[model samples]
Target: MAHSTDNVILQGAHGTFAKQLVFRQRFGQSILCKRPKKSNLSPTDAQLSVRARFLAASVYAKSVRANPELLVLLVKGLQ
Candidate 1:
C-alpha cells in the first residue's frame, strides 16, 4: 500500500481503476495500491453452507416483493 498526497487526480479518489489498481481513503489520507488477485482455492464446507442460506433468504425476499399482499402485510407489521 502507498500513501498519496498533493496529487489532484488522486484527491478524494476511491474505488478500483481499470480493474488493476485500487484507490481508497484511510485515516483521512488517500491510498493507492494494486488490486488483489482472486483466490483459486475452492470454498470450504462452512462457506458453502452460508452461501446456501444467503441464497434461500434472497429468494424469499424476492418472492415477498413479487407478492404485493405479502409486501404490504410485512410493511404494516402484520396488523
Candidate 2:
C-alpha cells in the first residue's frame, strides 16, 4: 500500500511543479533550495520564499475581479 504522503508526491510530480521542482522547494522553504556551502551568489531559502510570496501576492492581486461572484466561482473551480 502506498503511504499517505504518496498522494502529495504524485501531485508535486505531475502538477505545476513538475518542471520547476527547485522553485516549488524554494516556495515551501525546503532545504533542497539552500545555497551550497561556500556559495555567495545564490539566494538563500528565505530570500527565495519571500520573492515567491511576493510574486504570488502580485498575481492574486491582479486576479481580483470587481464581481465578487466571479471570484467566488473562480475559487470553487480551483478547488
Candidate 3:
C-alpha cells in the first residue's frame, strides 16, 4: 500500500501490468485501479521507488502524530 497527497496505491505482488491500485480519501473505502495499456506495463522503477518513499514517509508522519511520545519510548528502552 502506498499513499500520496489524498490517494493511496496498492501494488499486488509486483508493479506488473494492470496491477496499479488507486484509493481516494473522498471515495470512502471505494478504490479504483487502471489497467496498463499495451504500450505501458507496470510503473517504471523510479516511480515505484518514489511511491515507496512517499508511503513510508506518510506512515511515519501519521504514527508520530498519533503517538507523540513514541520517540521517548524508543530512546528510553521501554522504561
Best model per lDDT: 1
State each candidate's clash count. Answer: 0, 0, 0
Q: Give the backbone clash total of model 1.
A: 0
Question: Mind giving the per-residue lDDT tens digits that candidate 1 earns over 1-79?
Answer: 5544688987899999999999889887888789988999999999999999999999999999999999999989966
In angstroms, the error of model 1 at 54 is 0.7
Angstrom error of the Cα, residue 41, model 1: value is 0.9
Between 1 and 2, whose lDDT is larger?
1
Over the full model, what C-alpha lDDT does candidate 1 score relative to the true structure? Answer: 0.90
Pick by TM-score: which candidate is best? 1
Worst 10 residues of 3 by lDDT: 7-16
Candidate lDDT values, in order: 0.90, 0.57, 0.60
* TM match of model 3 to true structure: 0.36
Using all chains and alpha carbons, the TM-scores for the candidates as numbered come to: 0.73, 0.32, 0.36
Residues 1-79, model 3: lDDT tens digits: 7444433344222333446654333444433456444765689999999999999999987887688598667658756
